[model samples]
Target: MPPSADPTVSVTLAEIARIAGVGRAAVSNWRRRHDSFPAPVGGTDTSPQFALSQVEEWLRRQGKLDEVGSRERLWPEFEALGDRDAMGRAIAVAGARLARLTDKEAGPDDSAGWLPGGTDLSDAQRSLVERAVGLAKKHGARDTFDFLLGRWLDTHVRQINVTPSPLAALMAEVAELSRGGEAGDVGTVLDPACGTGGLLLAAARQWAGTADVPASGAPLRLLGQDVDATQAALAAVRLLLAGRSPERESAWGVDVRAGNTLRADPHPDVRADVVLCNPPFNERDWGYEELATDARWTYGLPPRTEPELAWTQHALSRLAPGGTAVLLLPPGVASRRAGRRVRAGLLRSGVLRAVVALPPGSAPPHSVALHLWVLRAPAEGGTDAGAGVLLVDAADVQQEPSGGTQRAGRAAIDWPLLHRRVVSAVQELRTIQTTQTGQAPQTAQTTPAAPAGNADGDRPADHAVVPVIDLLDEEVDLTPARHVPKKATSANLGLRRSWNRFGTLLHELRDLTATLSALELSGEEPAGQGTVTVGDLLRAGALTMRAGQQPADGVVRTGDAPDDAVRVLTVADVLAGGRSSGWLTAPDASAGENAGGLTLTAPGEVVVVGAHRAFGAWVETDAPTVLGSQLYALRADPALLDPWFLAGCLRAPANARQAGTHASTSSRIDVRRLQVLRLPLDEQRRYGEAFRRLTAFERSLREAGTIGGKLVDGLTDGIAAGRLPGNRP
Candidate 1:
C-alpha cells in the first residue's frame, strides 16, 4: 500500500509545480510517469490535491527540494491555519514568545503560555509557535517576524495592510535628515498608525548606536498606536526585540497602544523629536466629522478624500519644536484640488520642507509612484525656518546592472545614491536656514553660487531651492517637477555638445530615410494576401502563446541586476524601443522556477504587451530576461513562420485595431483575437525586411526630434545668458 496523504496540509498540482520549479505540463507528466508520486489527498479530478509533506519527500528524493526555500515551505502550513483573523492571532502569539526570548525574560523551554490575554492555543498553533521560535533563533526575531508578516500580507495583500520595507527606510532616512546636523539629539520617535511597527523599527535602528544614545542609558522612547489590537501587539513585540526592556515603565515612555490614533490620541500632549510614518492612503471616513474641531488641524481641514492630509497634520502636531516628520503619501495628495488649501497653509507657515518623488513599485498599491513629504514643526515666531523650500527629484535614482539576470517590474532602490542625494538636498536647506538667520557662513562656499542677476541659478542636478512665497498659489502644487530648475546651458562646451548631437542625429535620420526609400523601391508588391486570426495559427502549431502576470514576490522597477540575477524586460522597456534600460533583477533560476508567475524571454521569441497601447518586439538580445506583467511571449516555428514577420504583423496598426475591438473597459487586448495578414514565405521575407527598416526609421526620427529640441533649448539659453553669439543669417 502506498503512503497515505496528510489531509490537514495539502497543495494543488499548480502549487506543486511552483514548488518544484517546473512547468505545469512537467508536473502533470511526473504524476503520470511516476507510480510513487503523491496520490490525491483531496479536491476534484481537474485540480487534485497532494499532501505537502509527501510532495516534499518526493521532491527531495528527486533532488528538486533545493528549489524551495524555508519560507516557501512554511507558507502552505500558514495557509492551512484557515482565516486572516486566526493567522493574525497566531502571528501575535508567536511574536510574544520571540519577544520574551529576545528580552531574556523567558527561558528556552518557555512556550506561548506566557503570551498576554491567556488565549488557549491549539496543537497546530503550538507547532507554529515552535517553528517561529526556530526561525527567530536562526534569522533574528525582527527579521523572522518581518518576513512572516510580509508573506502574510502578500497572501492577502488586498485585505492585510502593511508598509513595504523600502518606503519605511526612506521615511526613516528623511526623519534623520530632518534633524539637521544634530541628528543624534533626537531622543524620541513616534508613529501614530504604526502597522507592524515597520516605521518605528526603522527609526529605532537609525538611532541605535549614535553618540547621543549611550549604551548604558535608557533606550530611546518609541511610541506607536494602531486600530488593530493584534497589529499593535505585534508592534510592541517588535519594539521590545529592538532592545527596549519589557519591565521599562511608562515613566521611561515606551508605549505601543492598541487603539485608533485619529480619534483617541495616546500621547496627545507629548511631542516627539522625530515622527516617521507611511500613513493609510485614500480613506474616506477617517473621523473627519469628529476631528473637524480637533486642534491637530493647524492647517485647513482636510476634505473627506484627503485623509492623508489629516494624518499629515496629526504627525506635524506631534512634533517637537524644530523636529521633522517624514510621511509617505500618494502623489495625488501633492496636487489634489481638495487638499490645495491645506497644502498652501503648510507652505506659508514653513512647516512643509521638501517633497521627494520616488519611482513606482517603491511600495504596495504599486501602480503609481509615491511622494515623501519632509515637514518640520515651525519654531516659536517661525524664526528657525528657512526661506527657500528644497525639492529633490531623486526619482531616477536606481540600481545599475551588476552583471546578472534582471527581472521586469521590480523597483530596486540604490540606497547609497539616494541617501547621498537626499542628504545633500537637506544640507542645502540647512545652508539656506543659516543664511536666512543672518549667521556667518561656516565654510567659504556655504552660499549657493549663482550667475550674476539670475535668480534661477545653477543648482545641483535634480535639486531645487524654490522660494516659499512662490509656492503659495491657488493650485499650491508641490510636485518636485514643478519646482526643480532645468540644467544650465550657458557654457560653451554644453552648446557645442548639443550642436554635435543634433548634427549626428540629423545625419542618422537622413541615412535611415534613404535606406527606407531604397527598401520600399526595391521590393515589389505581392498579390493581396488573406487575413488569419492568431488563434488559427496557434491551433495549427505555428506559434505558442504564453502570457504571464506580474510576479507576487515584489515588483522590480529598477533595471539593474545585483549579481547573478536576470534582467527583466518590462512593458515600459518594450515601449521604449526594446532597449535594456530600466531593467530590474531576479535570481538566476527564478525564471525557471516561475516562483512569482514570471515567464522567461528567449532569443528569437516575439514579445507583445497585452495591455493598453499594444506593442510587440522580437527578442533580439541573448541576455536573460523575463516577460513582465500584462505581457505575452509568442514562440514561433521557424519552418512555418518568420519571427520578424510575426512581430511586424502583430504590431501593425490594422491588427492593433482588430485586437482593440476585443478589448475590455480597461483596454486590455487579447492577442489571440488579433488579425494578421498571411502571405507566402518569399513574400513575407520582403515585407519583414521592410518592417525592420521602418522600425529603424521611426527610431531615428525620435532621436532626431529629441536632439533637435535640446539643440533649440541650448541655443536659447546660450543667447539669453550672453554666452554664445546670437547673430545668424
Candidate 2:
C-alpha cells in the first residue's frame, strides 16, 4: 500500500543549513546577499519557509547537495507536506516494507488501509519510503524508525505531549514491580492515550528484560488507542517494527488504533493485566455532558474540570481483578477541590494504593512536580478498605553532585535512588497486605491498617504508610507532601563535612599565602605591552560578549523550581560570592532571542559584574548557567585569548577607570571599552594560570573566614552552655 501524493514541500532556514552542512547564519547570509536565492513560499518573515525543490536546485548549483544523504534529503520533503498525518502514513508504508523484508510470510496487503484513499504515494513520498527501507535494511528497522521518530519528536516537541523516555521507563518498571510477574504471566498491557506508544514500548522492553518467555510461545499483548490519528499511526508503525525485530527474545502482539479512548471506548470490553498512562491534564471537553452517565465512572462522576480523574477511573474500569495501573498526573489532581469526591471514593474503595510526588521536570510542562498514582482493581470480593495508602515524597531527591559546576538546589532527579526508595516502600506495603489478607500476594496491594515503623524507631521522612480512614476527611487530600514528613537534616554529618572542608581551606590558604610570598617582583619597571579594547577582540572574532537578561521581577524565582529551570547568575550573587540566587525556566530565559534562546555560560567563560563599586570578573567552571541582570558574560576563543586571562584583565582597576562612564561606583561600566593585554595564546595561558591561582586564593580566604566564624560561634556557645571545657567567667 502506498501513501497519497504530497506534491509541495517547504523548509526553514535551519533545515537548509543542515542540508548544506553549514550554520544557520550562513543560510541567512545567502538569502541576504544572493538575489538569485529562492523567495519565501510560506511562513512568517522571521521564520520564512522556502520551497524544497527550489532550495535543492540552488544547493545543487552551489555544489552542496552532494553532502546530503538520500534519507537526510527526504526529511525536508516530508516536512514540506506540512501534514503530520500524511508523514505518519508514509512512515507506516516504510515500516510495512521493512516488515515484509524480515518476515517473508507477512502479506503485501498488511498495510493496505494505513494510507489515505488507497492512493499511490507521490514520487517524493515514494522516494522517502524507499530511502527508509534502504536504511532499515542496514541498521535494522527499529533503529532506523527510531532515528526518524526522534527527529520528528524534536521538531514538534512543543506541540505534542510526549512522555519522556526516562519517565516512561520508570513507570514501566514500577508497574512491573507492583505486578510481580515474568513476561509470560502478564497477559495484556493497555495504554488508553498511548501517545507515540512510549509507554507501550517501555512495557514491552521491561517485560522482555525480565525472566525468559514461556515455552507455550504465547506473545504478550500490547493494546493502545490515541485520539490523534497521526500519533496513533506512528505508534502502530513503531510497535510493528519492534515486534518484527529478530533480536527480540519474547514475542509481542501489538494492536494500536486511532480513536479517542474516552469518547469512543476503543477497547471497551477488553480488560488488561496492567495499565500505564500519562493522561491529558485539565481537559474541559472530555465528553462531560454526553458521558455523564458513563458506567466507567465507578468511583464518582468526574467534575468537568477534572479530566485526569476521568482517565484514572477509566483505567480502573479496564483493569482485570488484582490488576495494577500506574498513572502520572498533575499534582493538583491529588488535592484540587473539584476532584475530592472521586479521590475520597478511590481511597475508601482501596483502589488508590499509593501517591508518589516525583521531582519537578520528571514529565512534560516541566515547571511543577508531577504525581504518580498507583492503583489496583480490587480483587474479586476482596477490598482492603482497612489497608493504608503509601505516600512517597521523592520530590526533594536530586542527583549527587559530580563536583564540577553542578550546584546545590539544582533539580536533577536521582532516578536510580528514587527507584530504589519507591520500590522498597511499595514492597513493604505489599508484604503487609499479604499478611493481612492471609493470601499469597500476586500484585502489590495496600499496607496493613497499622502504620509500619522503621528499625530505628523513627519514621522515614521521605515516605509514610497511612490508613485509608485517616485520609477520608472532608478534603480527602492525597498530596504526598501532606502525609510525608519533611526530610530531616543530617546536622552531625553536615557539621563533620563542614569542619573537614574548613580544615582543608585553612591548609590551602597557608600554602597559597606562602606561594604568593615567594613571588619575586621586578626591581625596575618593565615596558608595558600593547593593549586592545574588548570591542577590538569582538571585531577580530577573538571573543563574543552578551549582557545578562533583566528578567521581569517575578520571573527570577528561588526555591523548588523545576529541574529544567536555568540557574541565573546575578550581580548580587556575584557580589555576595555565592552560587546562583535565582532561577528561570528555560523557555523564559530564551523567550525573545532570535537565535532561539539565551546562550548558557560554558566552562571557562568569564562572567563580570557590570555595575557596583566592587566590580569583578570570574571564570565560570560550573555546569551551563543563564546570566541574570547587571552582569556580562564573555566567551573567548581559546586559540586567540585565554578566558581566565581576559577575566583578570577586565577586573583591573585601570580597565574599570577607562570603561566606567560615571565617577559613581554604582554606574555601569562600558564592557566593550574594557581593555585586554595583547599576547600570544601560550603567554595568555601562563597568565591565565596565575590569575586562576589568585582567584582561588581569594575564594579560600572567604571560605576560611565564613567557616572560622561559624566554628568560633559553635565553640563559644558550647562553652557558655557548659558543654565544652573553658575558663570560668
Candidate 3:
C-alpha cells in the first residue's frame, strides 16, 4: 500500500478496491451496475480516495456500516427504556457513567458492540467508538449524525483504520492558508450543535494539535458542547486522538447532551474566535415560549415555525466580535419571507457577509442547493465593511440526469465539487477581505435592507430596515427572492417580448449566413464573406463535437464528453466561446453516447461554449477534453482559419451577448448571456492573438484554486429549489 504521507487533495480507485476487498475490475463492474456508486473523485494512482463525506455515503448504500447495538445488545444487565419518552429516556440512560465507558477493553461480547456483526473495531477504541456511532442515530440529527458517527467508528477510530489522511491534512492546510492572526495562534474554536467529533477533529487538526491565536492568552482552547453524551464522548475520543487528553487538556471542554441549543445553557460565558456548524433546518418548534424572556432571542420571539432563525441567532450569539463563521443553511433561508426578520436582522447586524450556492445533490435524498452563509462579528474601532451581499450562483455543475427525474433516492452526496466550491468561495471571501480591508479586516457595515412588499398584499413600504420582529405578522415567506431586491435587469434578459424578437432575428441571421456560406463555397458571389455555422463546421472532417441528451435513471449531471472520460458526448458543454469547458462522465457505458456519437478532442481543437445566456461565444484550447455536451467542439481547418481566432470570436462584444440561452431547466444552465456574433475572420484572429494569454491566465487561476470537494451547482441548487432536481423551480 502507498504511504499516507502524500499531501494531494484527491482519492484513488485502487485503494477503494482494497478496502472493499474487490478487484479494480470488480469495482468498475460495480460502478457500471450500481447506478449509485459515486464516480472517481480527486484521483490517486494506487487507490481511489473519495471525499470522506462520499465514502461514508458509499458504505451506507452498500449497507456495510454496523447498526447501533439493540437495546438488549446495548447492555445485557440494563433494562430497556420501554415506556419512557425518548428524550427523557435518552437523558436518563446517557448520564454519568457513559464517559467512563471509553476505558472498557474490547472483548468477545463487547466486540459485537464495536462493529457491524463481524466487522468490529479493534483498530479503534472499539467499545467507545461503537457507542458514538449508535449515539448519533439514537440522539442526534439523522443524516449529518450518520456521517459523523459512521466515519468516527468505521474509519477514524483506530490508527490503522484512521485512513483518508489527505482530508485531515488538506483541511489543516486550508485553515493555515486562511491564516489571519499569524501562524500558530490559538483562541477557541466553537461548534454549537456538536453532534459527533468530526468537525472538532477537523478543527483540531487545523490548529495543528495546538491553539495559539494572537490576541488570546490561553493557547490550547477547543470548546464544544453537544446535546448528547455519546456525541460528547465521541468528540472526546477525537480530541484525545489529536492529543487533547482527558486530564491534560482540561483547559478546554467538550460537553455533550447538556441542553438544547435554544433553551438550555452550556458554556454560556464562552466566546469563540471561529464558529463552524451545520445547524438543523426548518424545525417547527425550538422552545421560544419557554425562552420568551431569554437573551439569545434579542430581536423578537422566534416564530414557532422558524427553527432556522433560532439557529442563526444562536450561531451569532456564540460568535465573538470579528469572529468568522461558515454556516451551512437551507436555500430558502436566502429567499424566505417567514425568516425575513432574521434575514434583515442578520444583514443589518454587521454579521452577514457572503451567501454562496453549492452544487445539486451535495446532500443525498434531498436535491436542494445548499448555501454557505459566511458571517462575521463587528470588530472594535473599525468601519463596517458591509455593503451588498456577495451573491454568487455557482450551482452550474455538469450533472447527469437522475433518470428523467430529480430524486437520487439513496445515493451519496456530491461532496467533492461542493467542497471545491467551499474552498474557492472561502478563499475568495478572505482574499477580498484581506485585499479590500487590509490585514486587520474592518467590521462590515450593518444596515437593514428595505422591507419587501408582502406577498399577501400588504402595503409596500419605501426602502428601510424592516423590523425582524414584525416578519412573522404575515404569511412567512423567508426566501430571499421573495424579498431580497433584484438588481434591475435589461428587458433582454428576463422579458418575453425581447426574447421573441431576439429569437426571430437570430434564426433569420443564421439561415441567411448558412445560405451565403453555401453560395460562396460554390464560387457564386452572395453575401460579403463565405460563412459557416458551428453546425456546418461539424459536418466537415475539420470540425467535430457532440450535443447533450437527457440522462439515465438516477444520474445528476448534464453535458458532453471528449470520448476518453468515456461519457456520452453532448452539446451542453459547448459554449458560444467554441470550447467545451466541462464533461460529464457516463454513470454507465450503456447509457449510450451523447449527441448520438463519440468524438475525440486531440490537442489544438477549437470548441464553442453554449449556454442559456451566452450563445455564440467561442474558445480554443489544447486542454484535456471530455467534450461537454452543451458545447460544440470544433476542430478547425487550420489552413483557412486559426483555431484560436474562432474561439475568441465567441467572446467578442460585437457578437451576440446571450448564447445558448434556450434552456428552461433550473439545474441545467441557460447560456444565452455568453453568446456572441461571428466577427470577421481577420478580426477574430487579431482578438484571439491578443487575448490568448489572458484566457490562459484565467484558466491557470481556476486550475490553481483549491478544492473543498462539495458540489455547489447541481448539488446545492437541486436541493434548494424546494424540490428534487429536474423539478421546476
Candidate 4:
C-alpha cells in the first residue's frame, strides 16, 4: 500500500536537479513548462520550493526517478539553471529525510532489501530510488552510484570540496607501505579533515582487496573524521559500500561529522599509527586568539594568515611518539615570513622528516604548486636524523607544450616511478640512522636463553631486556626532498647489488643502440624518400604526441588556466598546460591566467610540439592529460610517431635548444620552425629511437644504483642496529 503523501517535501530547483539527474537550470525549465509541479511550498530569498510529493511525481514523469546519481542529465540542467539560487529548504528537507532513512527511523522494514531499513515507499519518489538502487545491483554499479552520490551531497554541503593532491597521495601510500615493515601490520590509521576521505580510502585499500592486499581484513586499522555532516554521512556510506563492514559489522571507524582539529578536538587522546592529510593551504579564518595557551602549539604561535601551520601543529600533537604523518601544504609553510619561527622550531625539533616539491599539477587543474610535509616522532629522544635535506625537483614532470603561443601546461604524476623513488629514499634514510649510531648486534649459533635477571626488572630477575628503537629521522625543512637525497638512495651507483640491474639496463640499451647503428650503417633507409612532411601526414591520422620536462629540484613554476588547467609552458611540449581562457574568465590570484600564455588540452587527444608548423608540433592521446589545447593535438595518428617516441623528440638537447631560436615570437614559438628544419617519416623515426635510448639509459643507471642501495641498506644498517632481524654473534 502507498504511504501518506508528503505535503511538506518541498521541491526546489536544486531538489529537482537532485532528483531528475539534471542540473537546477533544467528543473527551472521543467517548472516553467509543466503545470503539474505543486505550488511553491516555501521560498529562500531568491528561490522557491514545492511539495515533495509533486516533485516526486515530476521525476517519475521524466523517467529519471530511478537514476538520481547519474551524471548524464545533470550537466544540462546545471547549464539551464544558470545562477539562480536553489531553494535551500528543499535541501534541508531532503537531507533530513536521508538522515532519517540512513538511521532507519523512516519506518519498519517492509521489503527484503540490501539497506537495513524496512521503510515503506510513499509516493512514486521512494519507489524510484529503490528501483535505481535495485538496477545498480543488477549491473554491479553500486560503487559508481555511491561515489557520485557522495560527491554530489558533499558538494552541496560544502564539507569536502577540495581535490586530491596527487603527489601527496603518492607520499601517503609510500609512507604507509614502508611502515608495514616496522609494525608488521599497519594498524589504526586516521585523517581528520577527511574531505572526500581519499586518504582514508587509500589507506584502507592498501592492504585490502587491492592488487597486493589479501582478501580478509588487514591487521591495519582505519579511521576518519570531518567537520561537514553531509560529508561525514557521505563518507560513512562510502566506507560501508567498500565492504569495510563484515556481515553488518562496521567497515571502518570514520566519522565525517563536525571536526576542526584546531578548534574542537575529537578523539582527544587517541594516537594513530599513520596520519595522512592535506590540511587547508593558507588560512586566515583559523582562530588566532581563541586558544592562546593550547599545548599543540609546541612550535610557536600559529599565524592565522597561515592556517596550515596550525594544522601542522595539530597533526604533530596527535601522533604517537613513533608514528609518522605526511601532509600537503603550500610553499609558504616551508619558507614564509610570519610562520618562519614556528616552521624553524618544528624543523630543529627533528619532528620534520622530509619535504618534496610537487609539480604544478599537484593541485587538480590549479597551477598553485605545493609540497609534501613529512613528519615523524624521534626514535631515541634526539632531534638529529644525521642527514642533509634530500631535495627533489618534480616541476619537470609538468613541462611546456611542444610549441606554439599557448601557455605551458603543468605535469602529470607518474605514480609508479614516484612510489619507488620515495620508498627507496626513505629506506636509505633508515640505513643512515643505524650507521650514525654504531654497529649491528651479533647472535650465537644457538638460541640465546633468557638472561639470569628478570626481564624488565620485574621482581628483580638476573638481567633486563633492552627495548629497541626504530631507525628514522626528521628534517628542519618541511619538504620531503630535504631529508631525502637529490639522487635516489637506491640509485646509489656505489652499491654492488644495484649495479647488477644497472648493468643489465646499460647492456640492453647499448645492444639496442648498436642494432640501430647497424641498420643506419647498412643504409636500407626507405626508397622513394617516402616524402611525408607533417602536413601530408596529417591526413593519414595515426599518431599521438606530448611534451615534458625534467625540471631541476626546488623551482616551482605555475601559470593560470582559463580555469585551473592553464599553465606556464615553453614552446617545447606539444599541448599547453593552461585552461581555456575563453571559458574560465575569472582572473586568478597572481593574475596568471591572463599574464601567461595559458592554453588547453582535452583528455586522450594527441599533442605535438615541433620546431616549426610544417614540423613544429603534432600528436594525439585519449587520456585527459592536461594542456592549454591551443598548441596542437592530433586525434587519429599512430603510424607516424608513438607517444614514447614523441616524448623522446622533445627531450633531445639539439631539438629542444634549437626549437627556441626557431620560435617565431619572443615568448611563443610558431609551427614554421619544425616544418622546415626536419622532414617527416624516417628522420623523425630515427630521432624517436635516439631519444628513447638516452631515456632508457638514464633510467637504467638511476634504477641500478637505487636497487643496490635498497638491497644492502638493511644488511649494512642491520649490522649497526643489532635488531636487524637475522644474524647474531
Best by TM-score: 2
Q: What is the lDDT of candidate 3?
A: 0.45
* Per-residue lDDT of 484 in model 1: 69
CA RMSD per model (angstroms): 7.4, 8.0, 17.7, 14.3
- For each candidate in turn, the TM-score is 0.72, 0.73, 0.41, 0.50
Candidate 3 positional error at 723, Å:
33
Model with the higher lDDT, candidate 1 or 3: 1
- The candidate, 1 or 4, that scores higher on lDDT is 1
Better of 1 and 4 by TM-score: 1
In model 3, how large is the Cα lDDT of residue 145? 30
Give candidate 1's error at residue 457 in angstroms. Answer: 17
Task: Give a tens-digit lDDT track for model 4, residues 559-619.
Answer: 3233343333334332222232222212221122111222334543445554343233323
* Candidate models: Cα lDDT each: 0.69, 0.73, 0.45, 0.48
Ranking of candidates on TM-score, top first:
2, 1, 4, 3
| Backbone clashes counted, model 2 | 3
Candidate 4 regions with alpha-carbon error over 4 angstroms: 1-141, 150-169, 177-184, 207-220, 244-251, 379-389, 398-411, 438-729
Number of colliding residue pairs in each model? 20, 3, 179, 115
What is the C-alpha lDDT profile of model 1 across 601-643, one tens digit per residue? Answer: 7787888777666456554455456666778888988888877
What lDDT tens digits, residue by residue, belong to model 3 across residues 257-374? 3456677757787777776666666656768678777788654556777776677777767867767666667787766656666666665565666665654544311356666566
